[model samples]
Each structure stands twice: as structure tokens, then as C-alpha cells.
Target chain A: MSEPQILIIRSVSFQQLDQNLPKLQEAFPGARIALLTHAHGVRQAEKYRAIHRVLAYPFKEGFHYRRRAADMKREQFDAVVIPVTNLSGTGFFNVLLFSLTIPSKRRFVCNMVSDIWEVSASRIIWMGVRHLLFQAVSSILSLLLGIFAVLFLPFGLKRLSKNK
Target chain B: MSAPLVSIVMLCWNRIEDVRESLNRIREQHYPHIETIVVDNGSTDGTVEMIQSEFPGVRLIRMYKNMGIEAYNIGFANARGEYTVIIDDDSFPAPNAIRRMVDKFEADERLGVVAFDVRNFYSYDDIKKEAETTDTVTNAPAANDYFMSFNGAGAGVRTSVLRQIGGYPEEFFLYNNELDSAFRIWDAGYKIQSFPDVVAYHKYSPKNRTSWRAPFYYTRNAFWTAWKNYPADMALRITIQLIYSCLYYSMEQRTTVYLKAMWSAFRDRGRLKGKRKPVERTIAEQLRVPWNVNFTFYR
Candidate 1:
């Protein structure tokens, strides 16, 4: 019934970009949102400009730490959707305890983290079934092709084998 | 010359003040016999003049241009002492750091590499305790924590072992250098050890932006390392990883960055392919990380 604000917490790839933004927009039709990204994610946030704010967080190896703390503390974001691999250290460590930091309510925590990072055993089993089907089909096709070749090979081989 | 217990071989480019601060720690050590070799990586910042004027006795191997990581090889080749340390110019070793590492190496012959804790240089004071203690934040013990995988930063590696393995893989150019070397070390039949108590400091610049060639190096080098070291059974995971990353990059509207990562991998894959070595591992452990995500240093 009401709009919900979000923070893109970690750095993630763009594959899930389209649906995530629009779906969130539709879910909270009139809700306002903001995004926080590392230097790499800034370019990505440009596409979904409907959100309130998009700021790039620097991650240089030689960058300053005081600046990192100030930035994390100074910022005001409701929900963070950080889809990054290694956006931890001072960055995530600081934001993990933000007053507004919802604990696994948004996709940031649900699918991207602990409660979200966990996978169901049934899901794993389903993945295994698909993997097996792929292997089985490939094997069956090769076997049939191998039998066809075996029957045809004797004609051409009979002359060569006789000479041998 | 009391046969110096250890020699620190550092590769530096510019960052004169950073280099000086790092060298000062070694010079101030109470340990009697230790050497410091600073390979000036073609620094125009007058770093050469500073080192000459200040640390006159410090071994300064001045090169005309950037020989890349090859400078490390030159430093290792010229090093003396029973153990040699490969330290980054920006990385500063703690007081008595080398002494502690050498003591451990001498105490254990099987110890191919000895690591001490490395805390963020700028945040060391803020994160010193967290870095020194073993916590869940990090999956494995920090190399700077005294006993890590013979990390390249603050670790004690036997001179004989390094010479045998040919030191760091010069072909790496940038990324995947450690894993490439680690695989060879593993193949050579020696255990890599970590020491948590021995702590040093790594003062990293806080400007971690994914710019220029960062994406290229990160994705490309990671894939290259995986292709080379992934057990044959685990080889296909490379494609899975690539697809996963590519799709994610695309969905995130970071297609350009993803493409750059792919290009970097393709361009530099030959080097990894050339050095590829098949590794032996138990079927079970190979399924776990450190088995896979072990060498993942995300950019």
C-alpha cells in the first residue's frame, strides 16, 4: 500500500538489473529509493535513475580509510541492494549496522546474504537433475552415432583390412 | 656481516615516501643481521635521489624503465641471506617482523613459507586487533597474521625453495601471480603455512575504483588461473563461472565492464595456458573452496 526505499548494498553484476528496479518500483508505486555503489557500480546505477540518489563508493587499494568511514556514516539510505562479490571490509562492515539497515527484509539481505545466501536442499537437488539430464542426453546421442558408424565402417574397412 | 638472517626485496615505483617509511621499519629493527634491497621501479619521483641521499647503504637496483614484475626476479636473484622477503613498496613490515618469521622458518624445515598478519596500513591502529585475531570475517587466516600461505607480502620463504620454484611467476604481469606460484609450490611437494601472531601492516590507498584495466585484469586473470589449476573434474566450472558473471554483468547494465573483463581474460589467457599444470587433490576436498574461491581476490 506504501512505497519502500532501498539501498543497493553490495556490488553485483547487471544481469538482474532490469527486473529488480522496475519490480521494486511497481511494488511500491510511489516509493522513493536510493543506491550506493563502488567506483565500478556508478555507471550501472545511471540506467535506473528513477531512484533518489546514486553515489559511487571508491575502492582503491591505496585509498584513505577516514574518508570511507565518513562516507558510510554520512550517507542516508533506507534499503541497500549490494550485489557485489567482495564489497566487504570497511564498506559493508560499516553499513551492516546502519539504523535503517533492514535485517534481510530487502533482496540485499534476503537473496544476497545470510538468510538470502542460503540455498534450499531441494533447489540443489533440482539443479542436480538438470545437470544429469544434460549429461545423459549427450551420452545417448553419441552412442547412437557410434553404432551407426560401426555398421558403415566395415564396408570401407573390408578392402583395407583384407589388404592388411 | 653476521650472515643476515633475512633480506627484504621490495619493488617500488614512485611512492618515495611510502618506500622510505617501509624501509625505516627494517632499518630500525634491533635484530643485528638483516638486509633491505629496494628495487627502484623506474621512479621519476626522485625516489632514487632520496634513497641514495638517505639510505646510502640500502641496496638500490635502479632500472631505466618499468621491467614490470620482472624487477622482483632481479631482486630475488641478487638477494643473500637464508631467507628472502618479497614486499610491496607500499607495504611496511612491523618491528622485529622478519626476525619472528625467520625464527619460525628455522624452527621448522617443512615450512616452505611463513606469513605474519598484515593490517591495513592506514587502518592498522583501528583494525589491528581485528586483523591479528582469527575471525569469521575472513575465511582463512590472514597471511600478515604470521602464518599464511607463504603470502608474497610479509612471509618467510626459504631461499632454496624460491630458487627451486623460480620465485614469483614473471608471466603473471599483474594478477594471478600468487596462485600461479602457489600451484607450482604445491606441485613441488611442500606445505604452505601461515603464522597468525606475526603481524605487519599493509597501507593501501582508499581509491579502489573499478577503472581503466581493473575489470579486465580481475575477470581475465581469475579465469586464467582457474583454467590452469582447476582439477580436470572442476574444469567445466570455468564456463559456469563465466556465464554467471557475464549474465550478472549484463543484468546489472554493466555490459561494458563485463565485456572488458572478458577481453582481458582472452588476451592474457595464453600466458596462463602456457604455464598450466595439472594438480592432484582428493575428490572431496577439491569440491570445497580454497579449492576454488581460494585464490579469488576480487577487484
Candidate 2:
């Protein structure tokens, strides 16, 4: 396969940015590497030699965040790498979203110990369907719980008042 | 007078090496009058045995099953120190960190928690390097502003305040327990602050770290924390916003963890019934992320 024209690395902490960036460069030779990270990490990310560009994800601004995602999609990255600690990739919802959004054919997830896997589009779709179903079911149950909470509100308030 | 007794409470689940390292660091603290407590969340590994044999002085609370963050409650109950330092198995304070944290608490009567600057490292060597190079005394101004919550990895809590708030919300099980406790602390008229000079190192090990559990627990506990602490109108508003956020993230991340967490939260709503003693509206407003900017994005 031909080398990617541009590559993006998305992470929450960007903890292994320094170590992972060079290895990624060797794998995707000549690819322009960009760092996509939380805004707080922008200054630290900028200091790295391997990162050709830095894109800070605005944590609080929904509209601006959407605009930033759209801008990234326009860049049309050839590959996206998400470094995760484990197979479940639990705290990486934002990273997963970015990888899917940027229109990258080669989406890779790696762990700190260097286990990397390519996530296929079909697999992504399957995961979405499965989890979305779970979410739907959970939402209904949660609504019921909310009703229960409302019912019990009086007692809770009484307890609070007693403590006061 | 001797330094007021500081209790170091750490939770371990099968990570024996990390726990051992943390305990050794605790033993090396520059501050005198410190007690260490280890709550083993039913480790199949030799964690319980090791703590018993190697660190007999440590107050070890052994459990038969992993109770997650709820296990900390047992440790807190047994804590004899005036201040309790809560940390994970893979985290520990700098030698002088406990001393500095105590100073902060003594300086401000309203201060309930003094958060440590938790530095994460992938390797033990790196942690050692950090310890060697870190400045124990600094003239640099620390951030004096009050924060909403403290990092669970490495933060100190006033034992009395912790007890007053009834420890952590046992219903939380794991994630977001810090925030739940923080809310109660704030409502009790105490402040939480982070000091850069007080440092701790987290191993940040990738091993045995579950992927779906964090998202699930975080999502579920977010609801509980809001419902249990926030004012009704504010809670409802935050819940609606959270639902939208979760829905968006679920579709985007292609994981049902968030939805499942929500469902579980709903299923367990009975636990929170009558548990709602909302914090003041002002406290809720100050602590909450503005709804408009709460949406997170990655470029």
C-alpha cells in the first residue's frame, strides 16, 4: 500500500506523544504528522519535533468543536492512530469519533505496549448498531429510575431538613 | 509539635508490584507521624499476603470481592490520621508532598481537600527520575483558586471532613466518586484546591485497564452525582444535556457503554431515592461546566 499523505494522532492526554510520534513516522514514511489533542496540551504538543501540525480540540465550545471536526474532515487524512491502554478503549470516545470523522481508510488503535489493530469500517458500524441498541434499552430503564427518584424526593428532602 | 498524623489510603486490585512500590514510598515519607492503609479489593494475586508479610505495620483491609471505589470507605473508616491521602495502587506522593498538603490544610480551616499535582509516568525509572529532580521547596506561586474536584489518584482529604460527608457515595461503585464527595464538601462550606508544589506520581499502567468499564461507570455515575447533589431544576437540565452528549458520543464512538451506563443508572435509581439533598444553586452553578461549552470535540 502507498504511504499516507497526512496522518493524525488523537489522544486524551497525548501521554506517549513523544515516543509514539517517531515510530508512526517510520511506519508511514514522509507522512505529515498532525497532533489532535485537548486544548490544554497544545503548548506541550507544539514543542515536539515530529508533529508538523497541532489541532487543539476545544473542550467547552460545541459549535467551535464541530467546526474544528469539519476542518479536519476537509484535510482528508490518509490514516488516524488512536493509542489506547487496553482492548476495550473505554475512555476514548472522542478519539474514536475523530478517527471515524476524518475519512481515513486506515484507522489504527494501539496500546502502550505496542499492540496495534486496524479497525474496519464494517466493524465500526457493527459496534455502533450493537451499542446503540444497548443504549436505547438503557435509556428506557433510566427514565423509569428518574420517575422513582422523583417519588422519593420528598423523603430525601425531609432527611436533608432533619440533618440541617 | 510532631506533624499531625497523616493516613495514606490506597486501593489495590491484583496489582501487587504497584502496591508494593507505593507502600515503600509511603515508608520513605519525610514527614513523621504517617499511617498507611491498604484496602485490597479481593485480589487473587498475592497482594494481600505481600502487604501482610512485608508491611505489617500497614492497616490492611482485605475483601473477598472487588467493590471498586466503595472499598475505600472501609479504609476511611479505619483511618486514624487527621488527614487522609487517597491514592490508587499505582500512585504515591513525593516524600515531602504529605507535609506540604498538611501545611495547606492547617493554613486554611475551610480547606477540605488539598489536591496533589499528579504526574503520570509509564515506567518506574521515570518515576524515580521525577522524584530525584522534583523540588521539595519552591517559591513559585501555586494556584490559589478553588477547584470543583480533586484527582482521585493523589489527593489529601481532611479525615474529619471526609467523615462528616459520610465518606464516598457507596452507590457510585467506582468512577466520579471524587466529584460526589467534592460536592458534599463544598456544600458543607469547605474548599478544594490544587497545589503545584505538592506532587505525586502515578504509574499510569496500561495493564488490566478495562476499556468499556470507565465509560460505563463514568456515564452512570455522572447521573447519580447530579441527581443526588444538584438542585432539581439544575439536575434535570444537566441530565438532559448529558443524555444528548451521551447519545452523540455513543453513535460517534460506536459503543453502547454510555447508553448501558445510563440504563444501569436508571435501573439503580432506587438507590438514590431520598438521597437527594441538593447543594446550593450557587455551588452547582460554580461547579458545572456551562452547557454551551460542554460538548467536547477532537480535531
Candidate 3:
């Protein structure tokens, strides 16, 4: 196979980049690495030696971000990697969404401890669906709690004031 | 005329090296009349001892436990300066930044807060390089001219105005407290402005980069801010937007942090009963940014 072009989506933390980028380089020898990060982080990311190109994801929505994403998709990277420092917590959702938007032949997820694994696009889509289901259920419960507060808090406050 | 006293209030919790450097930068400020206050949030890493020994002039308040952003209240209470500069343990103003902020306030009686140009750096060397090379301008426009909120990382508040608003919501713990205070400041007929000339460096430490607490508090406090400050209709609209955004984020991240935050916000909303004095429609319009802009830019 020809030398691969790899893109790494890192939201923050250069330390994570330091830890994970070398492993990626070792795994894909002679690969051209590009770093994509938040606009504010572009300056810092540029200083890293491993990255051949740096792409800034605009912090705003609308046409600019969409255009940028389209531009990245045209790059047609062979592999895309997301460096996640935390696995148990809400993984970097913004980074994940951005990664999914760009077309890549292979997708890899890496953690702070240097564990990298390839995940199928379908599996990621399934995770997204599960999250939506969970969110729907939670939203109903939250709305009920909010309704309860609105209905009962005034009375509680009035009684407390009378006691005072 | 003598320069108005500018009090620098900083919060520290176990980040000894960063705090030390921040205090040193404050000491180097050219602003003549200044007082420095450091609130130690029950740090076990000898941060308090270091501050006491090295910075003898700084007034230090020690909390028994980590009270989060609420500990800033103690520091503000003790501040005697006409304007108070709020900064994190890892943040500090440039030498002339405070002077420029004070001038901005002096020039505009309606101005209540002056936000610094907060430049975040991952390493101390980069911060030092930027500080040395960057030229200070005497006049600069507000970085976010239409936006009302000031960054808590490095912003100056008129003490009288801050007192009028009753300071930050103690229950917020952390995150979005600035927006809560900004709403009150605007409602009181004061403006919050930011200038490119007034710079502060924030050492964006890499540690604890992926904690769930940040997303949780940010989500929860955002709801409370809207509930307590926005007009009823505006609040409802913003609430719906926030819910949608949170749910979308939760789905994308495959985590329940947003759900928990919403639940917590609902449960603890009673704390905001008497505090719910929504701002006028004009102020609301002035403060409002498009939801997408707010989400992508700020959050």
C-alpha cells in the first residue's frame, strides 16, 4: 500500500498529543500527520514537530464550519485518529462529531494510556443512537422535575417565610 | 489625581508554582495603587504556606474546604479597591493592563466591568515570550462589542457595581457564574466591555483535561443563569435551546453528563427564588447571541 495520510483530532491537551502521536507514527511509518483542533488551539498545535499540517476548526457554526469540514473531507485521509484522554466520561463529543463528518478509510480511537483501537463506523453510529435514546428518557424525567419545582416551590417558600 | 486602587483577587487550590508566578506578575504591575488578595480553597499542597512566606503583603483567606468559585466572595468582601480584578491561580494581568482597565472605567461612568484580552498558553515559556514581545496599545475596541458577559479568568469589576449585584451566585460553585453576574450588572444600568489592549495570560494547564465535573457544572449553571436573569419568554426559549444542545451533545459523546446536569439544575432551582429578577427587554436583546454562535464560540 502507498504511504498513508493520517489525521488526528485533538480537542485539547498537548500532553495527550505528545503521548499518542509517537505511537501513531510508529504504527503508520512514513505517514503524513495532520492535526485538527479548535481555532484557539491552532497556534499551540502548530509548534508540534510531528504534524505536517494544522487545520483549525472554526469555533462558530454555519457556513464557515461546514465549508471547512467539506474541505477536510476532500483531503480523503487514509486513517483518522481521535485522542481521548478520558474514556469513561462523556468522550469529546464535538471531536467525535467532527471526526465522523470527515471521510476516512480507517478510524482509530486512542486514550491517554496509549491504547489505540480501530472502531467500525457502524458501531459509532450505534453508540450515537443509544445516546439519543438515553437522552430522550432523561429529558422527560428532567422536564417532570422542572414542572414539580414550578408547581411546588412557591408554596414551600411561602411557608418558610411564614415560619421566619 | 491619585490612581484609583485596583484590587486583584485570585483563587488558588494546590497549584503552587502557577500561583507563585501569578503573584509575582501582580507585584510587577505598573499600576501604582493596588492591593492583592489570594483565596486559598483548602489546598493541601502547601500553597497557603508558600503565599504567606513569599508574598507577605498579600491578604490571604483560607477556606476549610474547596468551596469552588464561591470562595471568591470572601476575597471580594475584603477588597478595599474601587475596582476588583478577578483572576484564576494560573492567570495574571500584564504590567499596564490594570491601568488601562482603570482608565476605561474612568472614561465611561456607565462601564462596570473591563474584561482583559485573555491569552491562553500551555507553557510558561510561550507566555513569557508573548508578554515580552507584545506592544501595549492605549486605545482598543471591545473584543466582543455586542456581548455582555466578561470572562472570569481575567476581568475587572467595579466593586460598587459588583456589590450592587450581590456578587456571584454562591450556589453556582463554578462555571457560568460570570454570565449570572453580567446579567445583573447590565440590569443595573452598567456596561461590561473588553479591550484588546488589556491583556492577561492564562496558563491553561494540561492536568485534569478530561474531567466530567467541568461539563456537569457548566451545563447546570447555564440553566440557572437563564432562569434567574432572562425575561420569562427569553428564558423559556433559551432553556429549550440549551436542552436541545445538551441532549445533542450527550448523544454525540455517549455520556449522561448533560442529563445529570439538567436534573441537578431542576432539583436545586429553588435556591434562585428571590433572586429571579429578569432584566429588561432592551438589555436582554443586547445580551443575546445566536445559540449556535454561543455554543460553538464560547462553550
Candidate 4:
């Protein structure tokens, strides 16, 4: 139980962190736990003194991911934990990115309803597919709406000018 | 040790010439500890090569595709400075703008954002005309430290403070992202104010953009902001107010664009639900709820 260090790559909101921190702390009472969360989580991280370190990790952009990965390599960790309940596309990317970026012996993705399980290659592939599918659908919807907006724009502008 | 470095971050789309001119303006600034970082969102107009060849000292992060307003997050990640000045491609800050904004932040530790007096560079008449026509609500002019939202084009933010509140709402995609981020900043116990003396001139072009998309984003994001930042009751009230305004514009202009905006907002209600984090009453009061009803920005 007396592990040296642990990292939690949090891609979730501050609220989720507030809910899950105690459980995490209880599970790893001996290890020094560090958190990688968004900038907004910094103030919130203040209350949880159990967590040894907090780094404001930008979870959205890939370029930042690379930068953070480089900065994170300075310290070695025994384990990395990811909460899966509030995971989004960016969150998934962060998990994949950090997994590659940081070297660790054990990696776990946890959820409230289930037990902690190690992330596998197939699981990452599945999440990636889901993320891509969602993105493709979103882009298609935007394109349709954009074309619709443009089609009706000429008449709208013309009428507005007439009214003015 | 030395003075805190300021990273002037310009989010450029395809305007290569404007980007070059804006860099020249940055070079003209009297400030000493400054670095220029341009986040070009997938521009095919030779913007990458131009910046690499000409502005060798400038740090450039090029995306393969246009990622909209969220592209600035890349610049924020790479920015090595105490303060990050957000700039638009066509917006030009005065020589002393950076010095003044940094000084303001130095004076007030709680100041999260400092918005510049963004005057339309075209003409006074054009400003007046914009005021009359646009449905967007511009910030009412104030004497000093007026509680208002940040203007993405010419606002200086403490880099540390920005990370605390998370960066700009990448979900906003395009317009109104500044206000969305500002609300979060306010909720984080930071002050966002207008520094009237610090000025930036915005070209506010009419031809370079597709004017049709402006109304759509304005309507949708205004409603989205109301929902995401307000309590349930106030959120509902503001949502209704926005719908009414959109309908009013739709009826007046005889265009479906406003309706499309309303529809888009309504359709995205579930997405809005996920992002909602109601601010404290104090912060919510500063939001100026009713003002966002017909809120329009000069594009």
C-alpha cells in the first residue's frame, strides 16, 4: 500500500472531483496523489490537501497535450487513475495522450457504479471510434444548418434593408 | 527578477495581410518584455510560410483545419508569459496598450481580465450605424472598472488566472466565447472590467465575412450563455426573452435566419444542460441578465 506516487488525470469538472476525491484518497492512503485537471479546478483543488500536487492541464487542444506530456515526464509515478463517469472526447484524448506521455506501471479508469479496471488497447480504440462518430455527426449537422441559413439569408437581408 | 513577460496572442484565420500588419503594430509597441504568438486556425492562404519567413521571432502554432475560436487554446498552452493579450487579426492596439493593461493587472490582484476601449477603426458614423442595426448588446460605456465582459480581440488576461477558470469555452466554437469565459472568471471570484483609457482599434470589416452567420451565432450563443450561466428561473426568463427577440427580428427582417438561430439554440438545449454551472448570486448580478436578451456584437 505504501506506493511512492500516483497521478489522476482529471478531464472532468470541479464538481466531479469534489465527489470523487475522498474515495480516491481512501483507496490510495499511502501513495502521494497528484492531480492533472483544467485551470478551473485549481481553486477547487485547494480544499483537498490529501492530493500532493495539482497541475492545470489543458484537456482540450492536442498541442497543449504534447506540451503537458513533456512537462509531466520529469516525475515518475507508480500509477495513474482516470474517472470514466464524466469523460468526454477531450477527456478521452487526455487519457490516451497522458498514457503515452507519462510512463507508469499501472493505469486505471474508474467509475462510481463499477470497480476500477485497467484501460486496454481495445477500450481506447472503442472510445476513439465513438468520439469520431460523434464529431462526424456534429459536423454534418452544422453543415446542413449552415446551408439552410445561407439559403434564406438573401431574402432576410433584402427585407431588412427595405424596412430600414 | 526581471519584469513579467507578456505574450501577445493573435488568433488568425485566413487574413494573411492583416496578420502581417498586426505583427508590425505589435513590433511598434513600446513594451520591453513581450513575445508574439499567433495561433493560425488552418489557413491555406500562405499564412504559415509568411509568418515563418517574415516574423521569425514570432511563435506560430498552425492547425490543419479551422477550429474556430477554440484555436486560441493552442496559443494559450504555448504562451510563456505572465499575461496573455488576446488579439484579433484586424484589431490593432495602441503603442501603450500592453503597458497600460499589465499595469492595471499589477495594481489589482483580483483583476482577471481587462477589456480595451475597442473603437471601430472605420468611422464614427459606421459605429453609430452598427449600434442601430445590430441586435447584439454592446457594453455600455463607463468611467472605470465597470463590470463587463471581455472583448476577445483586445483583452489582457493573467495567464495564471486563465488556467484557474479553464481556458475559453471551446464549445462556443465561434462567437460569444469571450463572454462565456468571462462569466466563469467572474464565478471564480475574479473581476473583469473595462479599462477605458487602454484602447484598441477594431477594423470590424463588413465584406470579409459572411454577414449571414453573425445573426445565427449571436442568437444561439446569447441564449446558450443565459442557460449555462444562470440559475434555472433566471435562465428560463432570459431564454424566453431571447426567443422573443429572435422572433421579433425574424418578423421585422422577414428572414428565417433568426428562427434558425432560435431553433439551433433550442435543439442544443441538452448540450447546454451539460455545461451549466450556475454562478453565485453576486457574480450572477454582475452578469446583467436582461442585457443578454437582445445582445448583439458588432461583427
Interface RMSD of each: 17.8, 7.9, 8.3, 21.3
Off by over 4 Å in 4: A1-164, B122-141, B144-146, B289-299
lDDT of each: 0.54, 0.70, 0.73, 0.66
The Cα error of candidate 2 at residue B109, in Å, is 2.2
Q: A1-164, model 3: which lDDT tens digit per residue?
A: 77788998764345446556667778889998888765534554554566789886654332232335646757888888877655532444445555678878888887655668887778677776876676686578558655655565445434323123
On lDDT, the stronger of 1 and 4 is 4
Tens digit per residue, CA lDDT, model 2, B125-166: 332223234564341323322235777999999999999998
Listed in order, each prediction's TM-score against the native is: 0.59, 0.70, 0.69, 0.59
Cα misplacement distance, residue B8 of candidate 4 (Å): 1.1
Candidates sorted by DockQ, best first: 2, 3, 1, 4
Encode model 3's per-residue lDDT on B181-216: one tens digit a residue. 988899999988767567787875435444567778
The TM-score obtained by model 3 is 0.69
What clash count goes with each model? 59, 4, 0, 8
In candidate 3, how many clashes are counted?
0
Residue pairs clashing, model 4: A39-B163, A39-B164, A40-B164, A40-B166, B136-B295, B136-B296, B137-B295, B137-B296
TM-score of 1: 0.59
Whichever of 1 and 4 has more DockQ, that candidate is: 1
Q: Specify the CAPRI tier of model 2.
A: incorrect
Candidate 4: TM-score of chain A is: 0.64
**What are the chain A TM-scores for all the models, listed individually?**
0.42, 0.75, 0.78, 0.64
